[model samples]
Target: MKTIDPINTTNPNGFKNQASAALEDTNLQTALQRAKSGFIEKRKKAIHLVDDFEHLKTQAQQAKQSALDNLNHHLALFEKNVVASGGAVHRAKTPAELNQIVLKICQQQNAKLVTKGKSMVSEETHLNAFLEKHGISTAETDLGEYIIQLAKEKPSHIIAPAVHKTRQQVAELFKHNHELGERDLEEIRALVDEARAMLRKAFLLADVGITGANLLVADTGSVAIVTNEGNGDLTATLPKTHIVTASIEKVVANMEDAGKILQVLGRSATGQAMSTYTSFFNGPRRTEDLDGPSAFHVVILDNGRSDILNSKYKDMMRCIKCGACLNHCPVYGAVGGHAYGDVYPGPMGSVLTPLMKGIEQATPLPNASTFCGRCEEVCPMSIPLPELLRQLRNDQATKGLAPKLQSMALGIYGWLARKPRLFQLTMGMFGRVVKLFKVSHILPQETPAPDAPDTFVQQWKKSKQGHSENE
Candidate 1:
């Protein structure tokens, strides 16, 4: 209902500033505690259940790479399949064009109340804002999304929109916005009950239901989506018109390919044996179906991806949105999602936001990594996240977008280190300078007291002298 800009909402110390502040907020601590453990533990158990899960990961990653390497080929195959399956396909080369195409559908259908089921593509386009600007009322049916919608904030994490919210906040929000007096289970259930009731009405009366796809099959022209809450199922089935928005690369070759994707997606993302509901819509519903939307539209969005093809950074397109990369990232663990200041966050967000918006707008994002490879290690799609980040860092440094003082300091250090004599002299002087503080005596052994008698060069000299390392 209200507009949330990523740039204005996120704090800028990257994650440390937000996480330390969050540590003190009892409410946020409670909200994040579950998120931190629950996701990892559940996924661990789920991944262990499958045979060949590791091998499957390798296969999936290779498959995604193949798709990205030859995207135009796959996209054409996808378009042909969808048309054959009776769905209309629209290609939007830009966000503004995507918005116009979606609005045209809503206006044509005389849509007044639109119910949504967690489409990130819609978030990418700021569709709610665009639609509301034209007087169309949109409601988010996913519980986390509904909480965020009520709060008038952007999703902190892609998969878990309100991952940053505490139960008390939800309780307070329900009380303030929907009249959940006293916040009892009767009240909480009443709140849940209330959302179900409200959304139920919107579903019945809505002319259009909009959603984002988890995957698209080029072989059958089908829209594949996974959800725990079943809201996606309702939004698609109950409405007269169903509209799906997704980036251009979501297409896979066939149902078998989609299954391989789902295998890793559930395990890596949430650690579930299977998502509660998985739907494959082959062009709305067939005439044989008793209940289904009469018309189905799939909008392919390419706001900025086409140019990334064959570029060093295009591996980003391999993301499946499982949130595994976010879960495993050290920086993401420390700061949480809000700091990156975008629809996506953590490693995946860092790679995606820069690619979509340009490194110029998000120069700080590349440096957000600690060069931690966990995100890439666990990526089911095996995207070279650290490699991409390294490239972006180089891009920023070359462009003078990196902090001048830090860059200059590194340059000086590099020059000195290249010459051993100058390097040793500089190091010895630096050590003596730190020694002057007398504070070095109190410092932990982990840090070599710059003046520590056994510096790297000292060890190197001793090794050349054939002295024992310990001596």
Candidate 2:
């Protein structure tokens, strides 16, 4: 296996600092504000239009459950079907193995330039960086992905890779990278056209193309890619060789199962009934085919997912990569994806990251949530995100991965929670100090903190004194 360069998996105890910095970044704030309500409102409108939206969600969940229940069986059947279709399936137990498999395919083809579609699994494994380090130039075809590629950043959102970027920021990135002279790319159409023109050249010249799967069908050995831009079609078709990098959990029983999930995936991710391009590539181009890749390969990675399947975090594997959970999450809307300090972020990432990288490295992620339950509420696949996060926190506590200071604070809080009288007294004193801070203008005067109400003990005592006086 080829040794891939180490990417930043997670920052140790860095979520708070990263979140504070994100809160302060003017550009990020502008982009986030623009996007915060759009996804929420659009999804609301889209889901409302469908009379059976909840039914679709239920069907999707059932399909996912069925797939997971027979994961190994479906994977085996998928591999068999792929081989029967004249395509190859590579099972990688780790990221290193996946990278090596992809690299070996490229090297065998003597690939000099690789054109890529939006593959979050590739991002998860740091595939672009790995390929570039080994001397292969890569081009990102998706407009959002292309922008982020130039910016040298991982995707902030699964569907909208460059959602953190504003039109102005995109204009700057284009002006810096492309040779277009003094063009007004302030408009989205202009920026998109410029990227499309640039990517078209790379698409024709590249030897290999790589994409991620929305779902893999076991019955036909097809890799289904759902995209709005149609760039994924070009990326998969133009190159001589096509490579798909997906996790093992993406496999489904058949095309029917794929359709069941697809119904919910589009509405949940981008508020579309159907994406512009939902292409399925089963194998290499047939002799009668006009166009397609000469070779097709599917690289399925485990990368701690196998461990998750057996553990309490198994529900996470049902995620369809719909950005709905992130869009609906208040914490994600405020701080954006980068603050979580990993490739994945928001509610799903909080649970997935700690499991993938271990609780020690990703201790802050599970604690990043407010337990608002919006993620689970909006998830089309019905994944229980809050429950899974609580599981990670419990695992962390069990392993003693939490900081001593935090442990001490929690210990004190636990003690206070147990003693009713002492807790009431402490709360009364704390409320007075808060009121004092407000009165003296010690805290921010712009936003007044709500003074704590009288404790239960005090209220009870006052009622008793009033009764005694009446008697």
Candidate 3:
């Protein structure tokens, strides 16, 4: 089997070009349209079934916030418990460190074949590529992840990694890759079965398995994994060694707090009351255990998250990776995730990519929002995404990353606002010019100038005059 090469998928700098290309891709547009409404409606229906979704959101938010407030204590407790349960804990300050640590473990195990469940952190570190470059064979067990892996592409959506792929595209990919020899590939079930059959062999023969954690229970030292498919469980148990890659923010104070977050996580993510498989692995299997990985390792990654904890964007740490914001974001709907050009995409990604990578490297990501407030409205964690995006834009201006023309225009507008009469006079002249020359084309395409007879200032003056006469 051919392995994924080390590819540079983090291209936030090329957002404009990628977004333009995404807009023109007919197949991508079809896939986006098909998945968009289903995700939105499902979340709405699920949330409505609850008596008070707001209360649930509050509880989850509080749980996450409390954990973050005492993050050090919780992480230490988690590590201690893991060690107590016969599991080892490894801390990585950077992505390179994470890859190196995982590589060291793989080398120690003399692993040839490795299987993986869906891990966004691994994607962030590009773990598969790194392992493959070191001559380790990796197989993605998650159906969505497997599809993208076959295509040699990065995940487009957080939960739905292959959301950008159409059914036809997937069939073609399978046909090219799999030697099933003219088996029926038209139906979704057939495709799923094909993937399952292929991965089952990898499951039994795999030397190592890797998965991501939804929440790390600090009290029990448990890694909670939620998945609709049973693949995560299989991936974790089938191999002798199981590795978990997670960020430090994933650690909650206790199982109860983790439960609180899980209540809303399913509703906000996939509209399930509980996912099909919500498994908690405390440690490796004991001697009496029937079936489980013998060796368990938890790799806790910092990767700038510790800095974020102390920063103004600390509110962002509460994100559950639910992708509710992505489903509702109009900007995301229009351009799709590939346009963001990073491991993460959409509202959360826009704010996070800039912060995780440098603001300078991901300058365009922060500016990718419509700021319609839907993302924050639907957020289970109430992350204040628009506010964060605005702050990033402010940072861009502060760092001189914004365009000179845009900065000068905003400066002139700010100066004019200080003198109301002068501002009104300047605006009146500009409005007339815009109307006379039909220069609305110069404005943003999404928000063209309204064809009103008079400006708001002119209308306000007329209303004031009428009130004075009546008095």
Candidate 4:
């Protein structure tokens, strides 16, 4: 994979330093623990209530795979339907192309400020930077995205972008940024209301609103948005022109297929009956409707996804960003999102960043996980995350991106393992030898200073002693 202005993933010390600093942030730790537990409980209860949860998973997986297999055929159909519904479809092959298409529309419409919902594709393309460069002001309307944007931080969690922010942290952010008086804003609802009031003005005055679709239906050319906050509705509706930035992979065959995915999406993400607002837009506003945008534009970005569609990494395109994987990820729970230093994070990020960006630029990410398959179990799509991760690891090795030490070490082990006698001898001698070390570990990569085994080797030796005596 090719990368633009890549960062050095070769510096092991740099990643260690960054991850260490993240681990030390007590506020982030507390917030993550609280959010993770709360979300897990909510999801478990929601899953129990949904009678067809398992059924939905199967249906959703099949639908997604089928859609992916015939994406080209469906995409063309979607463009036709979009035009038929009075919306323009713009095809962009790269991030720069997508940015320019949106900016050109903004220029034609004389748009000064663009109100935006949480669109990861936009963030991926550095759309905010691009817009600002073109003399257009852009603000994130999603509450979590808004908070992170003000703090100049990337989202750690895909669903709850600001899940790492404590109430106290929020108060400070609001006080420092909004100057919302000296009095405390004790209620979460009050904080939400405050954000709503501010966003209302932006919504009313903005010429164009931008959002990312949860899925796009090829049969009808509809962009489906599932949100609990209801901000998606306002952002996409209140503006004169609504622009959607989505990739080709997010399309499904029809609304029925979309429902299958949506059913599992919230159940696996935050545990809700359904997202409070599940809005579907079949183009721009119709002439008959009293409300809705007059001009609607859909910008489909390919980026690096087309290449993925043709390779082993294509399974990743099935991701709906439900964030279930991140929610249960131990490493993500430890360091939060900032440590990833990219728009996406956690186990999903591990498999994705490398494929989307480049293997060398994101080598540290794949190793960040513990090979825990909790992500796969919770994933409604059943993407087999651990298997894919191992594939990525293999790819890393083939590309000469893995650590040289690890490559050499595994090679030696494999050489011995091929000969049963040699392997057993090595293991016996190794077990006997490690008894003298003050500390023991599988490798140098383990955390907490590689703790010493207090009595493991001795216990094994004693067991052997007992067995010999019995014999």
Candidate 5:
């Protein structure tokens, strides 16, 4: 088995360097271009199919908000029900604690092999690396997860973890990893087939399985996960021990609440009415049950989410992990997820990373946005992503974490804004300098600085004069 390296989580400050590198990588650019359009178009079509998608969004938002308002009570109830159903619930206040809890369970089961479904919480905790270090072999069963596992890379997109890999790149990775001689992998179907074939063995041989919950139904203590492939079901049922790693915010009131979110989740995520497999696990298998795990445990990780719940940015907790924000974000589409240098990426990440990590550690992430508002517009839960990002920027300035040059420039602009005439004069002079130096190249490509003969003030004044003369 190939050793998997721990994901680099200490580099939120290095976003600019990573973004620059991402721009220069041809393979990454190719992968990103192919994916961005498909996601956008598919979502458009899926949303069109729904008669009242906005109503569904509102319902989902309300459900999440209600759960959050009564978070402690819901969590307690969830735990109570889990124990009632013969499953155990463990709480971890930190990533290390979560890993330790999972490790203890694996040890208790004497697990030699673990098969995993897609779990962003596990990714945030870096569970695979932690478990592997303790002499356990883990296999990723989700096709995208499996690809990135073989390549030893972090997920570049939330929904499509291996979205940054082109078919050609994936073929190369499979060729280098798989022992099968000269198999056809040029097509997308072939790549998926190869992964399925590889993972089938892992599913049968694994002693334990770990999966993530899209929603944790507090009413019945059920772990709900949706996947395109049926791997999540296999991961949860085939093994003797099943572990679910989830964040505390994932809890919803009941199955009805879960359904409300599920309505928008699938449409907003992959442009389907629902994922191919929407499986819910109540607990371990009963004597009367047909097929399920023998031992079931749910590990809920805080990892700064509790702090977020009390903060002004609590609206972020309402997120359903749909990749709509990422798909619609210009910055994310341009640079891809890896450039953010964190577990989460794109517009949501810009607000989230700084709040979870320190502002000083991820100052660039907040500033990465153009404040286009597309992320907020497309977000199913209506998270004010751009507003949240601006607030983060404000926090950065408050802490003096923003660059000295930026602060000085903003200070000068603030002073000029108080005096209208001086502000116009300064802007006029700035416009001339821009035209003279041909500095439009320094501006964003989408909204380049214009080389117009007159500034807006000059144009307005001339128009007023012309109107006065006509009168």
Candidate 6:
């Protein structure tokens, strides 16, 4: 794996520059175009087949809201249940704390190598890099994760980590990394077979396996996970000790609630009616079980989520890690996940990265969108993403985080807008300037002048008047 400074990978202020470069990168653009169509059409078709998709989303949202509202109560119940099932629960308040807990577990087991399923929480804490630094080898079992792991890159998308890599790129990566002599590398089947062959050994040799939970059922103390590739099952069952790292927001009341979210999760994420493997495990292998872990541990991390619960961003907690928002985001399709430079990318990432990484550092992320409501439209949780983004922008401005000149300009504009006559005069002058620039070819011919009679403000006022009349 290539060396990466996980701490400095994201640049909230440099997002514009990163996005600009990504827009110009031909290979990335091609990959994004290829993925964009399939995800959108598949999700759309899947939803069309369900008559109660909206109702399911609403039920899922209510369940998450209920869990979060009484988080302490549910967490205690979940812990009690896990203990009853013979699994230990560990609590971590920060990423460093979470890493240390996992490290201690590995050390106690004398684990030299670890196998991992696709865990976004692990990515958030840079677990792989941390483990490697401590002389422990970790292998990513998911095909996309394995590719990015070999590339030493963080996951760009939540579910599909290596969506940015084309098959040709994967073949090249395999050629560079693996010592295969003139193999069939062009076909995806060949690539999967190659990855499977290589990872089979890692799975067998690993002393511990780690995975993320889709939802933690409080009633049963079981961690439910959905995977199309079944790597998660292998990661959880094949090793001596299994550790599940999950966010606090993943806890739900019961299996019934899990079923409600599961209805939309597969449809919104991969367009499948149900994932290939939807498995639940409460404890280590029982005496009757043939093959399973001897020990089970659950590490729940609060990080910044507790604060978000009482704040305006609480709706974001309803997110199920389904990549529907990413698939529908136009900006995401154009530049791909790396542009955001975080574990979670696309519309969800834009809001989340800032909250998790600090708005001061990730300032550009909230403003990266075109304010299209497609993210909210396709979200399985029905999170009001656009409204949340607007709130973030408002928070940013309230903190005086904007550049001095930009703040001054906005202040001036605010004052002028209060005086309609002056505001109209300024608009007329700006339009004239744009028309002059157009004639001189300074501005693009396609650009619309601000002086147009049907400017946005005018249209808004007209619509407002019509609404008032109807009322």
| Poorest 10 consecutive residues by lDDT, candidate 5 | 1-10
**What is residue 307's positional error in candidate 1, in angstroms?**
1.7
Give the alpha carbon lDDT tens digit for every residue of 1-471 in model 4. 211111233222234555777677778778988988888788889999978788889998999999999999989988989999999999999999999999999998999989998888997898988998989988889999888777766666788888888987876777778866776678888778888888888888898999998899999989999888888888899989999999999999998998888888888988987888899997877778989999999999998899998998888889998998888888888877767767678888888888887888777787777887888888888888888889988988998988899999999999998986677667655744564452357434442232333334454677899999999
Put down candidate 3 lDDT per residue, 310-360, tens digits, no spaces.
999989898899999999999889878888888889999999898999999
Steric collisions counted per model: 2, 0, 0, 1, 0, 0
Reference-based TM-score, model 1: 0.91
Candidate 1: lDDT of 268? 91
TM-score, every prediction: 0.91, 0.93, 0.94, 0.90, 0.93, 0.92
How large is the C-alpha RMSD of every model relative to the true structure?
3.6, 4.4, 3.8, 5.3, 3.7, 5.2
Alpha carbon lDDT of residue 447, candidate 4?
A: 28
- Please identify which of the two predictions, 1 or 6, would achieve the higher lDDT against the true structure: 6
Q: Which residue pairs of candidate 4 clash?
A: 156-337
The local distance difference test score of each candidate is 0.81, 0.88, 0.91, 0.83, 0.91, 0.88
Point out where model 1 deviates above 4 Å.
1-8, 11-26, 180-183, 186-191, 438-443, 446-456, 459-471
Backbone clashes counted, model 3: 0
lDDT of 6: 0.88
Clashing pairs in 2: none
Q: How does model 6 score by TM-score?
A: 0.92
The better candidate by lDDT, 2 or 4, is: 2
lDDT (10s digit) by residue, model 2, range 98-182? 9999999999999999999999889888899899999999999998889888987778887898898889989999999998787
In candidate 4 the C-alpha lDDT for residue 91 amounts to: 91
lDDT of 5 by residue, 1-471 (tens): 111122554377888877877787788888899999999999999999999999999999999999999999999999999999999999999999999999999999899999999999999899999999999999999899999999889898888999988899899999999999987887989988888888999999999999999999998999999999999999999999999999999999999999999999999999999999999999999999988999999999998999999999999999989999999999899888888888899988888888887788798998998988999999999999989989998988999998999999999999999998888888888877777777877444654345454668877898999999999
Q: Which ten-residue region of model 1 has the weakest summed lDDT?
A: 1-10
Candidate 5 TM-score versus the reference: 0.93
